[model samples]
Target chain A: MRHVATNNRDPEPKPLSEPVFLILTSLADQPRHGYALLRDIQDISNGRVALSTGTLYGALRRLLEEDWIERFKQKDTSRDKQAYQLTSEGRRQLRLEVERMRQLARVAGARMKESEG
Target chain B: MRQTSMTILWLYPAEYREAFGPEIVDTIAQRAGEACLQGLAAYAAFAAGEFAGLLLGALREWTTKWTARDGYMSPPDFAVEAADVPDLQRRIQQLIRGMEFAIANHDFPKARLYSDRERIMRARLDRLLSAGNLYQSR
Candidate 1:
């Protein structure tokens, strides 16, 4: 395995990149190939975050390395048409991230209400 | 136009080029054919992003090599031996040449066959590289 050494080893999972988050979310529902993932991510983000093929693949590689996603060759598809699905660990991480954001939003909403009042 | 797309693809690592190079080029070609000038512009932007990705991929590969040590990082069980890279690279080049020749002759079926071989070779290299097999093969 290639070893990338970094000094920081935080136990907490950091917020994902836009592409990565969208990717995980897309896969949370079903496995998807490169172009499909791109389309789904754009739709999910309301067309706000369009990922180029390069960006999508780069995130896919990292996710695979982290065991957050698994790649498989679809039996019906050609060899070049690779697909990815979220692993159990990936689902847990996504849930955690969503919860964290939910809490932040809740606090922000309360603050807005107070200010308005 | 095809040549330009091919040149852009060359920015990627050899293995990466082997794996997805054709697909990316095909996408660009399709865009060029369908959208005309606008598609070419889109392809340019896409190629630029891919160029950045190539650099990023290199950085990641090198970093993995650096941080990989006993108990330092948990590398996947498979590793590519440093020695295997050259031969694999050669094979990739050969396959690519065959693909190009077949494509030039309009033998698309043969071209696809070569393309599949290239993909398989690239996956093997990725596996070896992932396993931290950094040592020379011999």
Candidate 2:
């Protein structure tokens, strides 16, 4: 029997950039198209991160290339309304990112308390 | 404004433009609409930002293309279909040729990049084949 190599190892997740982190977080709830992603990202950041369409699509392409997201077919298959959803890998990465942030915050809080005392 | 935005969109690499052009245009239109509601200053700022972003994005994408790290190397989820086997094979052949040419030219870095792409493509091909999807041998 020929041994077929299975490339199934999950590599350790690196710390994500801010835009990537926001994009993944936006898709954590449900699938969204280009415009929806832009709006939601802004809303998520409380209007601080207003991504231009080019920047948004650039990030989307990278996410797709990483296999962390996939194009979702919806009834509205109009030229501009293609939706995207997070893959399981993407969700796992997001969860890991959140945990990383929580731990950092915890450490910072402890140090602040020690300083105050 | 839409026309100007489209013109800027044209500056992006052909593959990137084809994949996301219409959506980017639509998004820009929607953003412009929202900006229109906020008054002239907001709309002006939005237009300035949009043009600058698109120009910078086009430059970056073109640079990425020249650097051999475009979509050709990455296995996007969409490429998993069995129907893509032939296309994948063709890409693998091209990568081999590219690697050989790079070696002949003493461009070892480029050759290594091609080698990496070949490995990834072959792995993807193996996965598709192992899934038991019948594809015509090419």
Q: Cα deviation of A3 in candidate 2 (Å)?
A: 10
Question: What would the per-residue lDDT of candidate 1 be over residues B39-61, giving only the tens digit for each residue?
Answer: 77765675566556545655664
Q: After superposition, how far is residue A16 of candidate 2 from its true place, in Å?
A: 0.9
What clash pairs does model 2 have?
A: none
DockQ per candidate: 0.09, 0.39
**lDDT tens readout by residue for model 2, A1-117:** 111232423465678999999999999999998888999999999999988888888888878766677675456744535788887768988998899899999999999999999
Error of 2 at B118 (Å): 9.4
Off by over 4 Å in 1: A1-11, A76-80, B1-138
For candidate 2, the TM-score is 0.74
Model 1 chain A poorest ten-residue lDDT run: A1-10
